[model samples]
Target: MGLLPLFTSMLLFSWTTLNAALKITKVDLSIEPSAAVYRDTNVALRCKAEVLTFGTEALNRVYTIYKGDSVIYNKTTSSSEDLLYHLPQARVSNNGKYKCKISIMGEEKASEAATLTVEGMSTPILRFNKANITEGESVTATCLALGETGSLLFSFYDNSKEVENARVTSNELTFVPKGVGNHIIHCSYLVFVMPNSFKSQTSNTVTLTVEELSIEPVLKISPQDNVYEGDTVNITCSVSNVTKDYQAGELLLSQDTELLKSGKTSIHVNWTAHARTPMLTIKCRLYLRDVVKVVNKTISVSELFSVPTLKISALEVFQEDEISLTCRIAAKGIKKKSKVLTIHPKVPVSTPKIWVSGSAILGRKVEIFCLSDTGTPPITYTLWKANKQNQIAIVHEFNKAANFTIVINEPGRLNHYLCKASNGNRTPEQSDKLQTAVIEPMTEAYLMVVPDVDDISEGHTVILICSFLGTPPVTVRWLRDSDDLNPLKTTTTNINTTSYEFVVNKEHTDNYYCQAENRANSVESNKINLVVGMAMWKKLLIPGTIILVVSSLVMVGFILFTRSRRGKRERAAELSVKPASPKSDDSLTVTLTHDTEVYNAATDAASFCDDKEGRVTNGTRGSVASLPADISNRSSYSIPATV
Candidate 1:
């Protein structure tokens, strides 16, 4: 039993040792061309494993390659050689973390991760079919990425703004730009690989210049000389520089706003000139898709003929007289035309009546009108002074009535003036003579005092005559000094002379003037002073009475002287005793009466009579009172009664 237990123990120990020795030891992963490389380059990944086994024969090995956490490659082989994962023409998909794991007989080992990088792409090249083109024309642009493989997206840019994008297999794109002026254009491409995409740098820039279209239309007119009415003209319109490179276009010809013709490149039309439309404007237009060109021209048209006149056959016409009128035109270097009108027994003018517009005043103009009730037009009128041969004025008028103006140089001569009317007749029609009453304005006036103003006396009749050289009816007024409102007398008469009579009195003594007024004017005569004197009878009686009174005083004084002488002797003794006392009878006192009437004279010589008589009377009274008593009484003195 002891020997059997020892044998089991030894067998158990050998089995344990065999099981421990059959485990995998190490794993390693590596890549060929491990540094960064460009896209589309070939790359290889290899995985290595170390195992501890007692057999000398090969074992079945399972290999797996991992990108990130997913298995990308797997293989089962019965060899110990290292395992490899090969990428042909590697792309962006081949650029990530890679790890290798090996499994042999239920034993597995994994390697540390390694990365594969693919870098860079080829730069694009940009090209254009045309660098300079017109605004409406297009340019073809091409983008090329040489030695590049993948699906690519091409983007085109003008300045910095993207214009177009295209996805294509071939590395080419066509681009068209907008607007005019200089443009900078470039292109870039994006390469699409399995899970990622790559972009290439922009290509070289190209400059493009765009310009405006230069196509101008032309217009022409036939018969280039002066154009006249009723003449036909041909007009043509065309354009230049219209080549086969552009699409078919249209051409139009027009006048003002009316279209005349339309065609492909040119057009022709015929038109007639008219007098109403003297000026014309022609226009030609060329039209393409979005472009137009235009041209314009102007023309003038002139007129053909002239105007007409008329004439008469005779200067005077009468009743039952034949007359003729002709219409003619004088066309220089052209056709002459004429027409005649005749009338047998033509109507004669009625007697023409004449009158004046206003009163014919001297030194002023007057208008006279003459009219015929029946007469043809184109009548001639003549004004005569004394007879038919003496013509004052002649007026030719187209109407039946005519007028004339004349100054009234002599109003009396106006009565013989007459007017005559004629219309191609042998004898003119005569009117009744004009009886023009003229108004002569007052020019001179005279105021005369009748009965000799110097001999005027009180209670005598005086006459004031107002005479003027003017036509009547004239108003005559008598004024004293400046008081004209209350005239002493007023009268209106047909004659130029008038008179006013008054009994001379003191109230009538003042400055007197007469105003004579006619229709034309009023005039004042020279002023005269009127005075009243004493009556002629009083002049004779005053001096005679004075003489008689002086004679009577002489007689009384002589009588008184005798009586006093006798009384003186008787009363001598009494007189000597009484010492000469004053007594009423002793001195003979006399009283004389004087005339106090005053007279106003017309002349200075007659004004001193009243004062001379007063002085003489005063001297006589003084002489009488101063004489001695006896001598005073003996003087012959007689006192006359107051006259």
Candidate 2:
């Protein structure tokens, strides 16, 4: 191929433009495998000249090859055609500029220069995405070229041996480890150069360590202590070992045998505790294939709140009284704590009850009380007196108590009275009216004798009368001087009067009075005196003297009758001696004379004591006799007879 430049000039041109006498033709140059070539490879080059020339032809032609102006080959040929140059086993030193030249007899022509290139070797690197992992875990290995290459195929190797079916279209390879150990890994790539294929150098080795998988389950609950009833609790169960081989329902959370939530490696659940009865057991379970791990916790909730009870002290309460009250809660199996409080209850006003308890005498104080019932504190009491016109007037008032007192300064002040009470809440209450005249005992009384005169005779009965003026009926009592008399002798004749009937004597000559009394007051009547004289025996002596004078007159009359009878007899005898003369012969025997006396006596002894008069008469002698009236004794004279 080095003589191709002289053969191309002999086949076509016989002319040269530089020397006009000797003409040369134009030529061109080219090389096969025009792209860059690999080290220790082959390459070829060609040169041609124009076919026609318009100049004198040359008998002899020469061809030569040059490298950057230094000739390497020279040949002489008599034919005219194209020339060829061949470079076998090309190296980095053969890479440079090349050209071919032609000479006809003494004229020469040159072709254009052509260039050649040769590439050097490149290194490959091996790397992995993970250094250590558990068995059943996946890993990726990558191989990269430092220089540019086309149409590459990557293959992985383990332990200096090619892995079966471990080819990949990309520079990376992914696989799962079946066993646990430290394994060396690398990759190699094949590149197709122009006309053939070449394999690159093996990449740097890397080691992967695989171990057994182990993890523990953990349980956590929010608000670990002092939990109350009816509160929501959050429970979380988790595990640290997570991989692509993890299946659903690996971790579970439950409360008291009831499942709440399930997840892969971790789970969460919310539970509401029961009211006042919270004793729950929480459990967390982790299932790794056939192996199981579990954890548990217990929670206890406290009780609820209650209202307090109140208790007060003191048996009875009064107005403006201070008291204490204590409050506490009665909880079972709990400590007791008490709180104290102070209170003051109010007192209300009511009707006033009044009582008069003093004498009705002038210049005396009377007490009245107004009653207070259940009400507020600080009661007011007012006392009122009613006059003759039935009008009331305030006499005494008490601010803090329900009592009042008043002085009776005059006798006319004994009238009606009233009492009122109040506590400033509403209208005041009043008691019923009470009259002093009706409640007071009888007063201003007087004692009257039946004759209303003082002097009286002794050994005789006299009448003593008592009378008084008061509102209520009064009981009268009789007294001798200042002492009380015997009630048997002094008897009550009426509601307000008593009579004392007894034989008057020297002991009854003292002053006597009558007393009148009632519930309110007592009074005494005016004193009365009686006088008795000594004329009792003189009245008896006068009746005795009259009865003696009447008895003496009867005795003297009998004496005078006797004397007259005797004188009559003497006259009769003298007449008898002289009667015998004349007309007396036949009747002389019947002419006799006699004297008769008459006496009258009283019937009762009282008339027998009176003075009497006596008469004497003699019918036979015609003579009358009279008795002396002053006869003192009837037994001192007897009847005198005449014979």
Candidate 3:
């Protein structure tokens, strides 16, 4: 019985172990059409797996396909038959290394890699939208790569030079040709894939003829016959071919460079005839994009009256003299008549006078005046600068005077000015140059000493120089210690520098400055302190006296120190007393006495020693005896004598 149970347990364990061992083996991948095919061809990929399962129930199998390193398709099913993955309209992007994998339970297997290549693209066909083309017009071009797929780049060339490129699926582009000539055009395409791309051959060439615009402008005149002066004339300009098929452009009617009228299609103008010129040329212009068409016509104008003749009673006449004059005129088909009158002759204007008023300083406004004398009632005056062809200003006045206001910006620029006058005479008379001057404000003033202060000694000659930058006629003044009331020297000069020379002395050892003034402004120079040195002989005498006094003091100190050493030795053998110790509440008293007349000196020495050590406590008292007369008045303490 025990052996039967043991056998049953062993059988159960063996069956369980066999059911868990599910695996996949022998995986094969294949492509339907050949390994290499053209683009847009339908393709199929087959993945087959041989699975070994010991269980009664079916095991789930997973199928995965790869292109390069990316998974393209995956599926899970309970079937063991071969599976298929279809690619509709395969393109160049599908050309790469492909693989398949099968998985059952925990065990899987992969098949070897297979390569698919898509090659060969159709030659591109090129065509234009119209048979004939015109300048300034656009044309549509179509390019086709019949069997190609994926992204494509189409290029259009004109005479072997690329003009346009488009990346589109419809493959159509519009462009305009350059100039008026026959152009040879062709097109090509590029097939773009992930790992590889292919370019097709050029298309058949087509010749395109571009012609000029066919619109012509027409010009017409109303009075085609002999036209007379003071008559109104009409002009018309038109374009016959301006229709819906053409673009709208500008139309202009002009005489020479002057435009009389402007419109979209046609223009009209009314002008009065003049006898100044015998013949006049009128033009009509059609303006399109980068193209212009012109038409012109000429007309003649006749004079309506002849030139007048005048006769005077006297040839030589002065001002305020009366004279008789006769005026006559004759014309074709008109009567001639004469009229007598008495009038004064016209007088020409004299040369104009020019002057300036107001301050002529920089950055200030000033007025320039111009006047002409002994001229007609109305006269024209003009102002000009020397050597300049253009006039600065002009004015017409019955009083024969004019003025121009301007700000002066440059110094000494008023000399370049003149004026002219005219009253319908042969030529204008001019005035002389202007005589105005410009003043510039002082910017800086500097004062300097010829010999520096350090080098100056008694009886040395020193010079004080004042320099400045400003207009002429400047006043310079030298002051002592910045005191204007006590000026040492003052002068006016046209030059830039002025100076003063004097001998150095005790009175010269003081601060000095200078001031410069002009019509515009005044400025002061920097202050300078003068320190005169002593004479050489006096400097030597002062050191000699100091050395003699120091020698006498040294000898006295040596003699006194020797005597003090001897006295200290004698006092070393004298008896001394030691004081007793006291309690905290009791006071300690110390007395020092000297017997000589120098007792005040001993008291001073003891006080110095006490300061060096520390302050005495409140419970302690110190005293000196036998003070001197001067010392006793100040204090009573003195040192006592020792036996």
State the displacement of the C-alpha of residue 105, model 2, in Å, after optimal TM-score superposition: 99
Clashing pairs in 3: 593-639, 593-640, 594-639, 594-640, 595-641, 624-638, 625-638, 625-639
lDDT of 3 by residue, 1-643 (tens): 6999989999988756754676665898998887788777888998988877775777778899998888989999987779999877776667788999987755789999989887666788989888578876778889977866667888888898988554445678887887788889888987766566778899988888889888888888989678987677999998877678777788899876777899888888788776657788889988777667889998888878755667888864446768776777765554434454445566777788888876587777778888877766456667776667434444444554677776778887688878788767459888888889998888889999989989888788989999999887999989987466868988999999999899987667888888999888889999888888876667787998788788878878988877766565445223222236544465433333445343344666466435543333555533222222333223223322221
lDDT for model 1, please: 0.73
Off by over 4 Å in 3: 1-210, 222-234, 255-260, 268-276, 302-474, 477-556, 572-643
Which segments of candidate 1 are over 4 A away from where they belong? 1-273, 276-298, 302-348, 361-366, 388-401, 405-413, 437-443, 450-462, 485-487, 502-508, 519-522, 532-643
The local distance difference test score of model 3 is: 0.75
lDDT of 1 by residue, 1-643 (tens): 5988889988888656554556778888888877467777788888888878766857688999998788989999988888888887776546678899988766788999988878877788999889898766777888888767657778888887887554555555554456668899888988765466778899999998888776667899977569875578899988777777756678899888989899887788897754446688888998765567778888886755543445668755556666677665554344434444354444567788888877778878888777777776566778887775443344444343577877777755377788988766448888888887888898888988988878888898999988888988899889999576799998999987889998987677788999988877899998888888888889999999998999899989999987877665454223211114433333322332224322122332123223223222321321111222332233233322111
Best by TM-score: 3
**Shift in Å, residue 57, candidate 3:** 76
lDDT scores in order: 0.73, 0.62, 0.75
Compare candidates 1 and 3 on lDDT and give the better one: 3
TM-score of 3: 0.35
Candidate 2 displacement at residue 556 in angstroms: 7.5
Better of 2 and 3 by TM-score: 3
Residue-pair clashes per candidate, as listed? Answer: 15, 26, 8
Q: What is the C-alpha lDDT profile of model 2 across 369-468, one tens digit per residue?
A: 5555544545666677662222223322233345466666655544467776666656877777755532434557888886444446677777778777
